[model samples]
Target: MTEFRVLIVDDDFHVARVHSTYVDAIPGFTALSPVGTAALALQAVHALRPDLVLLDLYLPDTPGLELLRSLDLDTIMLTAAADPESVRAALRRGALGYLIKPFAADGLETVLRGYARYRRLLETPGTLDQAGLDRARRALLGAREPNALGRTRSGTETAVLETLASGGLLSAAEVAALVGVSRATAQRYLAALADEGSVEIQLRYGATGRPEHRYGLRD
Candidate 1:
């Protein structure tokens, strides 16, 4: 499979490093060195020509939305700006997806995978029929929407959810130990809940090694 090159544009060095690690961890995706300013981002885009950009709204030189207008490449807004106007402007300027900051560890991964699928669907040679077109559209749009995990919940899933609701962030291993399930099983449940917007995933970065992924109930 061809790797999808991603460019991350965030002013904060630590945040950019975290996002770069996240992008590289996903299969078939690789991140270029992140840029802190819109000017540097523009230069990187012109030079590297990445397949996608993870853009932040606040930049040192230029506003990310304005920068989006200037770039022809695909972009997803990753920002701390949660204002309605900012969201509306980003969508209007053709942002592929909008992810609020402090999102789960899997958040960018979800969007990146969706974009990869979307690109694959539309990039195939030949004219697309209505169904094909719809699938491609859904591949792009569905990633931004909350998944329909349905109202019914399994006993294990309910236990996982309840456990998260009761307290602070918990790792899958911790949840598994508490709920009497395998770590993989716990992860599956937590991921499903996160997709449904019922749970939040937080990454705790340390001085060394990979960041720890912790789960909590969304307020």
Candidate 2:
């Protein structure tokens, strides 16, 4: 299993470091030198020969979308720019994934993992059958559906997410009560959300018994 070399491109030194650290912690990825300007990014991409790039839309020298249009490497957009026009332009210009800034490391991890799966599928040997082709397509273009849960999108999942997004810690029981679902069902949804890095989890210790699990949206 070869590690994917990634270059971090962003104007803020601190944010670039944070992204680099996240990439470093993942098992099959490595972060190359972080660059703040689009010119430096292009230079580093040529010199370092990284396999992937995490690009920010707002750059000091050039627009990130302009850079994306120029580069042939696999790219993922990681920017605080959440405008619809920017997102549409990035996708139209061939960004493989987009992670809005102010996102948790878990969120980035999930995206990277999905990207890895997509790469693996494409690198598979020989002719691809319909199933294989479909799997690869889902891996690359199915982020909103067939989610990490392996279940169809549902109102229940949305409700659970909204309840947690209200900004407080909750147990499965509490989530169930609020979402009007059974405890088992709530636990299933919460566990799936945690797996996708959409939420964070912690063990809360009680006075005399075993610790209980608590879930909350990542801060």
Candidate 3:
């Protein structure tokens, strides 16, 4: 699988680090050092040419939307600005996706994954069928409600969703303990939910070792 490079743009250093961390945790994706200003962002894009940019709406040097219009690269608006005009401008400026700030890692992951899928479809060698074309279009833009996990093997998927819906975040191990499944089994179901956009997975970075994944139901 092709690994997509990401450049994170945000004014807050710590927030940029957090978003960078989130990007790194996801499979098939990697992020470079985050840039704090629009000028640095443009410089990084010229230098590195990342596959995508996680852009924030506010910057010390300029409005993020203006910067978005200036750039000729793909972007996902990761911002606290949720006003109608911001949304309209982002869409008009060709943002691949719009994600409000303070989102779980899974929320971003879902968008990235969908983008990757869309890219793959476009890169495919032949003409696309109607279903293929529709799927690819939705992958980049957006999708209708995802198919539920109820169709999985046995009734365990239902149990997993119920556990997640009950409130609070859960690690695979914790969910397994609650739902009477092995940790690995729990993790698989949680990943399925993340892929389906039914739940969001967050990474809890520790001082040592890899980060841990925490699962939460999507809003």
Model 3 bad stretches (over 4 Å): 141-219
Give candidate 2 regions above 4 Å deviation. Answer: 141-219
For 1-219, candidate 1 gives per-residue lDDT tens digits of: 346899999999999999999998876688999999999999999999999999999998999989999989999999999999999999999998999999877887777766766776677689999976776676676443223335577899889988887899999999999999999999888865654547766676689977788889866
Q: Give all TM-scores, in the order shown.
A: 0.65, 0.65, 0.65
Question: Tens-digit lDDT track for model 3 on 1-219?
Answer: 456899999999999999999999886689999999999999999999999999999999999999999889889999999899999999899898899988998888778878876776677788989877776777676463245524454489889989988998889999999999999899877765655557766667789977777888878
On TM-score, the stronger of 2 and 3 is 3
**Candidate 1's TM-score:** 0.65
- Per-prediction count of colliding residue pairs? 0, 0, 0
Clashing pairs in 3: none
**Candidate 3 local distance difference test against the native:** 0.84
lDDT of 2 at 135: 65
RMSD each, Å: 9.1, 10.3, 7.5
